[model samples]
Target: MSVIEEERVRGGVFKDINAEDEDQQPTVIESLCMTCYENGSTRLLLTKIPFFKEIIISSFTCPHCNWTNTEIQSAGRIQEQGVLYTLQVKTKEDMNREVVKSDSASTRIPQLDFEIPAFTQNGSLSTIEGLLDRAVAGLEQDQPIRKATDPVVAEKIEEFIQRLKKLKEVEKEFTLIIDDPSGNSFIENPFAPQKDMALTVAHYKRTPEHNAALGIEVEEEENDEKPGSDLDTMRNEVLVFNTNCPECNAPANTNMKLMILYVVNCEIWRSHRRAGNQNNLTDPSDMSRDLLKSETCSVLIPELEFELGMAALGGKFTTLEGLLKDIKDLIVSKNPFMCGDSSTADRAEKLELFGQKIDKIIAGEMDVHIILDDPAGNSYLQNVYAPDPDPEMKIEKYTRTFEQNEDLGLNDMKTEGYAEK
Candidate 1:
């Protein structure tokens, strides 16, 4: 009777979580093209926003190509939630209020068909007047912004720009609206109301889609199992991992997954007459699988249409990240040190530096190329749609050497004519 007591209190699991990895300082170096790795023409822009207390802006552009990408990251700790602000600009004084706009945030003027759309440029920290000036600058640089060529509409567009500039100097009626899904955007809200009209400030719950667009969303892997069938069936797109999960620190498969993910098989076909030199039985499956697994070849990662998988990091890459991590790791084995002395150590130092640059790419810290150069022709980047891979990926096919042919057992000469004596 005394031993009949059991207790239950808690219902679900309680979890302890750590903070996310802070963003590294904006980095710039001579880097290859993201769409076409033909030239190292990409540049990274990092600047601290002036008034947005502890926020930084990072952007990417390839002067040689048509690639423009930008992002705004908080230099401070994580925000608990996001906020939105709306201001009715009826007088000139309202234009001087401090404003914070992240790269993903969208700005609008309902009265006029004018807005600086989200993800357009490196995010800016400026007053309302400054933002308008930026918008004007953008239009001038862009040669293809279609507008109503009709005289009336064209004149109106020009008038809108003019009003935006005179926002601080002359009193006018316009609505300055800012919507930031990241909660990083802000309009000056002093504790004391200085005017008869107060700024409308609201805090709202951020949806998953909004979080993803801002690069702060967290996700767990659902189906990471080895895929079957052709890896490149969907336009040659697949995530090829060289290291374990970069975010989760998952264990590496050590290239075990390569055999099943194949494009073409290379094999030896013995001559019917060269019975003395060859074994009687042949297996195409075995040869193909062997070609995929045994041959030493480079893997080429082209510019992916989707964000290359970054479940390891909380935020995903837009255009600056790729599968360069695996490519760089593969480089070590091929880029060996020749047996020597001081020269070898020097080479190792340079290689280490090069690897560091590659790591930046895997972290989405910068943009670069992923090149795998294996002479065997058996290795592939897996799931490449075209022979050229992406616009930037480079591929070279070499004639197999006599010794290489012999190693693969392809040197048979006497099917109907000549056998080596």
Candidate 2:
């Protein structure tokens, strides 16, 4: 071959080898700055930050922009390429070597011990058959043949005897006695005599002194009248009265007065039933009509006296006559038939009857005073009575006014009165 041709061929072969080497080598390029264009072709010396332990460029220089900064761009661990050849050589050395030891400890087997009780060598079935044969022979013989006892049987009997001895050693005896106030007595002996015996007996008896300080006298029972005995039979009977208001023409408040009468009867019955036999009556019929009159008179006279004073104080009426006139007029207007019915008359009679019965029950023993706010004033009229007054009377009045406003409309003019008493 010509020299020039050989040189050209060698040059081509060298060019092919250089190309293969370039492909096999890892690619390394300059990391670019995203914000600005800069030919930073220098290799970045990356390392981890000291305390923050993040990725850092240990050193770098921008070739074109000439920008030099040591501060870390990305805050993370810097993972570099590992030494592959060194790792392969170390692994191969570990595989080729074999571990050796000069001395070793000897191993020994562990020993254990257990205990088993000795047993007889006799076969279980043969032993049972021999016992049965002996028993059968003894039963068939006319003579009383003694049967030999097995060692096991003897041992069991001996154990039972030992158990009995132990029980006897621990056993104890006790006795108890109880005596009652009514000449009654109880006695107990936990361990009783097992067999009868002949014995001599002696008794030494001593009488205890009757001490006055230790004795207590028992109380005797007494008979006393029970409560409500006088009025209990009068449950069905009540006296009612009917009247009218003359001025306002409203109901005369006779029912209201009757309610007051009931209250008075309840109070009297509760207070005086246990007082004496003077109030008691055997015949209810005999006391019926008379009882009605007295009770009404007693409650009405006092209640009217109270009403007179209350009326005068409240400026409602000047006298009892005027008050009665007004009440009659009111009743005539509000309850025209209040006094027209048999039921009304019956209720009036009942009220009178209850009053009379209460009067008899009280028997003038206790003064039946009508409690009044003013003892001296004789007013003819009083405010309406309510048993229990509402605590939220004011709040209810306000709520009712609002409800009226809502119903009547804001522009509508209307007068709202107090809620019905």
- Which one is best on lDDT? 1
- Model 2, span 340-388: residue lDDT tens: 2212464345334434434443343323222222211121122112355
In candidate 1, what are the lDDT values of residues 66-163, reduced to their tens digit?
67655455543234355566788765656665577877678888766667777876666567877877787665443334353456655666666676
How far residue 368's Cα lies from its native spot in candidate 2, in Å, is 8.5
- TM-score of each model, in listed order: 0.35, 0.12
Query: For model 2, what is the C-alpha lDDT against the true structure?
Result: 0.25
How high is the lDDT of residue 282 in model 2? 26
Instruction: Give the RMSD in angstroms, all C-alphas superposed, for model 1.
Output: 27.8
What lDDT score goes with residue 82 in model 1? 55
Candidate 1: worst-modelled 10 consecutive residues by lDDT: 272-281
Model 1 CA deviation exceeding 4 Å by range: 1-53, 57-73, 76-78, 143-156, 166-170, 190-196, 218-421
Worst window of 10 by summed lDDT in candidate 2? 100-109
